[model samples]
Each structure stands twice: as structure tokens, then as C-alpha cells.
Target: MKLNVEQRKIVELEPQGHLAVKGVAGSGKTSVAIRRVSFLKEHYCFEPDDRILLVTYNKTLLNFIHYQFNQLSEEETYDSFLSEHKTDVTITTIDKLMYRSFKARMTRLGLQLKTMTNRRQLLKVMNHALYDMKDNYKDVTILSPKFQNFLLDEIHWLKACDIQDLNVYQEIDRIGRATGSKGMPQKLHKNSETREAIFALKEHYDRLMLKEQWVDFPTINLMALREVEEHPPEGYTHIIIDESQDLTKVQLMYITHVQTDKPHQSIMFVADNTQSIYHLSWLGKGRAYTTIGFDMSGRARTLSKNYRTTTEISKAAYGLIEHDEAILSNVDFVKPALIDRHGHAPIYRFFKDHSSHLVFLKQEIESLIGEYQYKDICIVAKESRFLEDIEQYLLSEKNSSPSTQSSKTRF
Candidate 1:
């Protein structure tokens, strides 16, 4: 992929104290970040020990980064270079990076750390804590069973904000809440039995965590932040943060601790606030803070032209999201015109029922398979149940196909 004018500038950026880049979806922020790392290693005389940490939003994005890195380093010269200096660069999701940091300091900090691997485990812990509360504390059956998820979400929000203490959690206004279906802010009631129950559960959860030697996901970020703040990390030459708009305060704090005030070290943040769906974690309470971390002196830059979507698609998207003030403020104050590369308009199909939906989907898949490869087509489901059903249908379709067929159609 050839670097566009904006992307080239980012790739060729001088290794300053920090660089803050706001890029739209198609602006090649990842490519720029990767190229910048390569440039620093090749030009700035950065040693293999000076780790270039590339942190992204999630594991899927981390995999994408790894794939891109692999593709870039496939050449003999770069392959040998990356092979020899493997540890020189670290590409991972923020959670993985934080967990690594927390794990490294766990023994020294005298903290028995255990991370919950899945939602089932997390729910189990929450239920056990709730049961303990019910058995010990006043039976606050006022808190409905459905509120279990909301309570857990609130806990995560508090932890993300570094509000571990019960008093602080109660006093903190706003609580970084997400909106309910009624478009009302979902918040914890002050001085209510519900609040008390939640507090007790938090305590129980912590006790259980310590007892079981385990920690939840969001708590990992909080722990990492605490560790980094107490002991400022050293040795990293540069940090490239992707999808930074979705970062919580704790994650920002970790970044703050890692990146020193010195000019030699570099911190780069690549994000599009418009694409920040993670804020929905708190029911719309969280927004991308301008002064991410300790300072805002980082050179601010924007990538305006979107290279991925068609002009019509871009316009449609913009129209849909333009009403969001948070996106407008964090991304581009004055909605920048995206110079989208022309392509097919997005297709929307509606079905009366699940069976009809699957029939339409299968037919569409068969139709599109003639022009585009299986990898080129994607069927998006709104929920996991729908996805499971679709997957089973696709599997059955493949299984029923004739064995004599030379090529197999894949989903």
C-alpha cells in the first residue's frame, strides 16, 4: 500500500516527546504507526532493548496488527531483522499489555493475581459474591436479578475511573454511566440499599479474588495503572496506542506512567473518536478526554481523507453519526470532508422471520460467490444467537453439497 500525503507525514514524523493523531477509519493510522516504528528502529538508532510497544483496542485488532507486521516483514531483509530483534517490538492489546505488566510486578507487590478468562467465570464470581452478600448482609432483594449486569457494569465503570474505595465510588458524581433503552442515564442511586449491596458485593468480590488468586478484566487495567504510577516504567523507546479514544482513565494513567517527561522517549496515540464504540461500555457516560494522560502538549494531527469507503457510504455514515456531539468534539470539531474512494453502496435486506433471513442470506452468499471470494463476503448478525443459527445453516449447506464438487463454498 502506497502512503498518501497525510500518511507519509505521519510515517516520517520525527521522534519527538509525543505525537497525537486523530484518524478516521480509512486513514491508515495502523500503517502509519507501524511505519513510524520501523523508521525509529532504522533511523533513530533505537536498540533492540528499547521496546517499541504497539497497543491496540482488542485481541482481534492485535491479531490484525500481527498479520500486517508479518506481511511487512515477509521480505528476507526485514524477516531476518525482525527475527533477530524480535523482542525489540511488542504488539498486543491493552488488556494483554496491562496483564503482563501486572503479572511482572505481582510477586514484588505481594498481590496474588488471577484473571477471569471468560464471561461465564466472571458471572460465576459475581453470583458467588452476591450469594455471600445475601447470606451475610441484609437481604437486599430490592436489587432485581436483571440488575446483575447493570451492577457489574457499574463496578467496571468505577474501577475504570480508579474508584476502588466505597466512599469514593458513592460520592463520585456521574459514575460514567451508559444510557438505558429509554434514553435516560443509568446511574446508581445514592445512599440506597442497592448501593450498599453493590458495595458489599465489591468487597466480597475483592475478597473472593484474593482468595481465588484472580482478578476481573477491568480491574487488570486499574492494577496496571496503580503499579505503573507507583513505579514509572523505563526502557521502552516508543509507545504506539491505537484506538486510543476508547481508553479509560486508568489506561491513560498507565500511558502517563510509561511515557516519561524526557524528550528521548516517544508516545504516539492513533484514534478516531467517531469510532469509539467502547464508551458504550458505560452506557454513554465515558467520552474521550482531551488531556489524555498527564499532558496535552503532544502535536495534534488529523487524517481527513477516508480511503476505504465510497463517497456515498461515507456521506451516509456521517449523516447518521453527525448528531453525536462527542464524536464531533473528539474527532474533528468541524466535520472534515472525507474523500472516500468510490465503491458499491451498502445493501440492506429485511426478512420477515429467521428462516426467511437464512434463506436470503444463503442465496446472497451463493450469488456473490461468483464474483467475490468467500473471504470477501461477510454476514453480520446483531446477536450471538443469530450468529450461531447462521453458522449452523452455513455448515449444513456445505455438508449437503455434493462430494464431487471441485470447490467448496465457505462462509
Candidate 2:
């Protein structure tokens, strides 16, 4: 694929210090990021120990980026760039990077880090903490089963944003949770009583983890951030982060510390704020660039052209969130301009009951099976339970062998 004008500008940007690219879906943000890696290698002179790093959010994206690099290395157009600028680039997910840092820190402290791979074990610890909280906290709302998930989210958000002080958390506005006329219940962070209870629960949870020498995902990030802050890494000349909107504040801090202390080192973050589903408030508050300590005065760019979805699809997707007051209040919404292509407008069908919906889904799958391969057809649901219901119905009633590989099943 050829680079568009905006993408070319990003790829060839000079002095690439703290560059942030905000582009809609299919705006070639990832492509521009990958090309910039090659551009840095080709144009910049590096010491023998200098390193380049590419950080992604998940394994799927990490694999896709590796595939892109492989294709670039073999392509005739990029052969010269690949051969001449042969600098080592490290590609990894944020989770793996944090885990490595956490492990190294633990080793240095002579502590054995117990990895909790089982969800049930973590849940058991949480339940125990809640049980203990019932006696210590005055708010009975925290004891409700429905409040568990919300409490967990608040805890994770606090840690992700590096809000260790309860006073600071209470003073800050909760941006991600739904408020006002949205009809959704107000979040617990809004209520002083519940906020106290949540903080107590977090403390209890932490004590339990400390007692057991166990570390969960969020704790790993917090530990890693502290480790990196005290002992910044070395030899990194350039760092590129894709899907940066999904990253939390602590993770971003870890990225900053992992880079070398060179005066001319560069870091680039490519993100679409509209696609941020991780619920980080800094991006919604229009302070994401500054929050990461980056002065994006002349380094920021936005890609307006969307080449992925058709006009109809783009409009439909935008329509879903266009009037969402919560979303509008937080994100600087940029409406994408689609290429001159037309497709069928998204369809919405309503069924009276679950059985009817399954029947319709079965017929649709049977119809699509003839035209497309199994892997090409995906069925998405708002929750995993819905997908499980669909899978069970298909297997027991329809006698079909549908694959439920992930939340978004492909069969």
C-alpha cells in the first residue's frame, strides 16, 4: 500500500521527539508507525548499543506488526531500506514488558513473585477481602454482589492512573463512568460513602496480595512503574507505541522511563481517541499528551482520511456514539472522511425471544457459509454470555459445530 500525504508526513517526520498521531480507523496509523521505524534506522546514526522498540497492547497486534516487518523486509520496494539500515528493533506487548520488569525487580529484592494464573484464585482472594471489608466499612453497598465489578474497575483505574493517595482520587473527577442524563446509574466514585468503601476494599486486597506474595495484572504495572522510575533503562534511541489510547497512565510512564536518557532520543505515540475502550480519563480530559510529559506543540498530527470501512459503515459506527454526551464531553471527536466506496448499510433486526434470535442466526450462518470460509465469518456479541448462549443453542438444537474460540466467535 502506498503512503498517503498525511501518513508520509508522519513517517518522514524530523526530530521525531514525542510525536503523537491521532487517526481514525483504517487511517494507516500502524503503517505509518512501522515505516517510521525503518525511517529512523535509515536516516539516523546510532551508537553500537542503541536500540529501537515497538510496544503494542495485545498479542494479536504484536503478531500482526511482526508480520508487517517480515513483509517489508522481503518486498522489493523496501529491500534497500531493510538491508542498509539493519538496526535491531524490539517488538513486544505492554503486558510482557511490564511482567519482565516486575520479575527483574522481584529478583533483585530477593522475593519470589507468585504468578496467579487462575482467575478463580484471584476471585477467591477478592471475595475474602470483601468479606473482611463488610465488618470494617460502614457502607453496606460495598457488600452487594453487583458492586464487586465496579469496585474492581475503580481499583484498576486508580492504580493505572497512579493515584495512590485516597485524597487525590476523591478530589479528581471520574471521567469515564457514565453521568448525567445518560440514565445509567451514577458511578460509586461519585458517592463519598462508596468511595471510602472502595478504597478500603483496595487496601484489603493489597494486604492480601502482600501476605500471599501474589501479583495480579494491575499490581504488576504499578510495581514495574516504580522500578523503572528509580532505575531508568538504557540504550533505547527510539520507541514507538501503537494503540496508545488504550494504555493507562502508569503504563505510559513505564514506557517513558524504559527509553534511554539521551537528549535526542525519540518517542512516538499513535492513537485514535474515539477507539479508546480502556477508559483512561487523561485522554478524555484532553491532557493525554501533557500527562505523558511530552510537549506536543508542533509534534502532533491527525489523519482525517479513513480507508478501512466503507462510507455507510463509518457513518453507522459514528452514529452510535455521536450523541453520547459522556463520550462527546471527553474525546475530541474527529469525524473521518471515507473514500469513495459504497456498501450495504448495517442492518438491525429484532427478535421477540432468545430462540427466535438463535434461529435467525443459524439461518444467517448457513447462508454465509456457502459464500465465505468459516474463519472469515465472525459473530460478535456485547458479552461472552451471549456468545455462550448462541454456541449452546447451535450445538444442542441446530446440531452444528461452531467454533467459540474467543468472545467474537468465527464459525
Candidate 3:
């Protein structure tokens, strides 16, 4: 693909300060980030020890990026650059990076670290801790499902923001914690009684985790942040963070401290605030770039033209969040300009029950299978259980088993 003027500018950016590229979906932000890495290797001379790090949020994205980088490296134009910078660029997810950085230190300290992988198990443990708190505080409201859920979210927000001092958390302005029919009932920073109860619940939860010898991702992230602060990692000349909006305050802090002390070190953050799917409430409505020591001012760039999605799809997606206050308040939010391509308008269906929904989904898949290959069709659900249910229902259908035709059908 040929580079656009905007992408070329980002690719050729001088390797010296921070550069933030806020682009809409299908705006080729990831491509620009990859090209920038190639540009740096081809254009600049690096010390033998200097390295580049490209970090993402999850394993799926990490694997996709690795594939893309490998493809780019295979180009004949980059052959010489590949030979020199093959091992210099490290691509990894934030969780894996933190775990690797902290694992040795944790083992040396005689800490038996066991990460809780099962979601149901973690929730059960959390609920047990919450019930224990309720018994001690004599607050029946703590047992309310809504309150319990709010408490869990609040605890995550506290850890993600690295709010260690209880006093600071109590005094800090709660950005996303609003109170009304739509918001959380208890404000941890506002009501003293509520705040105290929540803090106690947090402490209790920590104790339960310790007792079970279980460590969650956020705890590992916090530990890594502290470790990075005390013992800053060296020899990283450049860092490119993709999907940066999903990063927590502590993660950003870790990135800042891990970069090398060399004069020409650079960091690029590519993100779309509107596309931020992780840590939605935790980041609140605050401008993360400035708060985390990035001076975007003139260094920021926005990509408005969306190349991947059709106009119909883009408009439909935008319509859902066009009036959303949270989305509108985002500092990096951009109304994407649609490309020339046009596609079928998105259909929104309302089903009374799961059976009807599954029936409709099966019909749609069977209909589409004639025109498009099974590998090209995908079914998405908010939860894996729903997808599993759909898969089973489809497979159980008499004389209409999609698995019999092709193994590529995906959920």
C-alpha cells in the first residue's frame, strides 16, 4: 500500500521527543507505526545496545502485529535494514512485558506468584471478600449486586491509576464517578462512610488474594511500575505504543521509566480515544497524554480518513455513539471521514429470547455461506458463552451442520 501524506510524515518523524497519532478506525494508524519503525532503522544510526520496543494491549493484537512486522521485514527494500535491526525491535503485550520484567525479581524475593486466570474463580473470590466485609461493617448495602459490581470496578480503577495513598484517593477529584439514576450509587471519594467501607473492602480483597496465593494482572502491573521507578531499565532508544488509549496510568508510568537515558530517545503513542475499549471508566474523562508527561501540543496528529470500513458501516457505528457525552468529551475524538466505498447498511435486530436470536443467526450464516466462503464469515458476541451457545445450536441442527461443510466457520 502506498503511504498517504499524513502517514509519510509520521513515518519520517525525527527520533527525538514524543509523537501522538490519534486516528479513527481504518485510518492506518498501525501501518504508520510499523513504517515508522522501519524508517527509524533505515534513517538513523543506533548504538549497539540501543533497542526499540513496540507494545500493545493484548495477545491477539500482539500476534497480529508480529505477523505484520514480519511481512514488512520480508520486503526487498528493507533487506539491509532488516539485517541490522532484526533483534533490536521487540514486540510484546504490556502484560507479558511486565511479567517478564518483574518475574525474576519476584522469585528472588521468595514471592510465589500465581496469576488467577479463571474469571469465574476471581469473581467468586471477590464476592467472598465483599461478603466478609459486609459481616464486619454490618452494612447490608454492601451485598447489593450493583454495589458489589461498583466496588470491583472502583478497585480496578484505584490500582490502574496507582492511587496507593488512601488519603490521596479520598481527596482526588472523581472524574467518571457520577451519581444519579445512571451512575454509581456510592461515591468513594465523596461520602466518607462509603469511602471508608470501599477502602476496607479493598484491603479485605487484598488479604483474600494473599491467602489464596493469587495475583491479578493489575497487581503485577503495579508491582512492575514500582520496580521500574526504582530500577529504570536501560538501552531502549525508541518505544511505539499501539492502541495507547487502553493503557492505564501505571502502564504509562512504567513505559516512561523504562526508556533509555540517551539524548535521542523517542516514544510514539498511536491511539484513538473513541476506539478505547479497555479501562473506559478507569481513565475517566481526563486527558491522559498530558497527565502522563506527554506534551502533545504541536506534536499530535489526527487521521480523519477511514480506509478500511465502508461509508455505511462507519456511519452506523458513529450513529450509536454520536450523542454519547463520554465520547464527545474525549480530547482526541475525531469524526471519521468515510471513504468512497459503499456497502450494505447495517441491520439492527431485537430478539425476545436467546432461541430466536440463535435461529436468526443460523439463518443468516446459512444464507451468507452460498455467496461468501465460511472463512470470510464471522459471528461476534460480547461474551464467549453466547458464542458457544450459538455454535452448539448451529451444530445440533439436522442436515444443516456448518461444520460438515467447512471448518473455517468462526464464532
Best candidate, TM-score: 2
lDDT of each: 0.68, 0.75, 0.76
Candidate 2's residue-wise lDDT over 90-189, tens digit each? 7789999888889878987898878775766777777888887777665455565455656666677887888887787777777757553323346645
Candidate 1 lDDT over 1-411, as tens digits, reads 457787888888788777778767777878788777777777764443566777887888877766677667424344565786687766678777787778867866787766686876777777777766666546565343455666676666667777667776566565335455433335556665566667767777778877978888777777777777777767477788887777777776676676534456788878776665564232123343453533444477878777777788888878877887655554333254657367777666777888999888877777776688777787676568899999888777765644213355544
Kindly indicate the candidate among 1 and 2 with the higher TM-score.
2
Model 3, span 1-411: residue lDDT tens: 467898898789787689888889989898888787777765664677778888888899877766665666345344455566678877789888888767855865778878876767767777888766666666535444456556777777788888877777777777656663344564544546666667777778878997978877778888887777776766478889988888888888888887887777889988887866565323335466778887788888888899998999999999999999878877778889888999899999999999999989878877777788777878889877898898888777734665445554444
Task: Indicate the worst ten consecutive residues by lDDT in candidate 1.
Answer: 279-288
- Full-model lDDT, candidate 1: 0.68
Task: Give the range of the ten consecutive residues with the poorest summed lDDT in model 2.
Answer: 402-411
For model 3, give the 10-residue run with minimal summed lDDT: 277-286
TM-score of each: 0.81, 0.89, 0.87
Off by over 4 Å in 1: 42-51, 69-77, 80-88, 109-113, 135-142, 171-178, 182-186, 189-196, 279-298, 329-336, 351-355, 370-376, 392-411
Evaluated at residue 62, the lDDT of candidate 3 is: 79
Q: TM-score-based ranking, best first?
A: 2, 3, 1
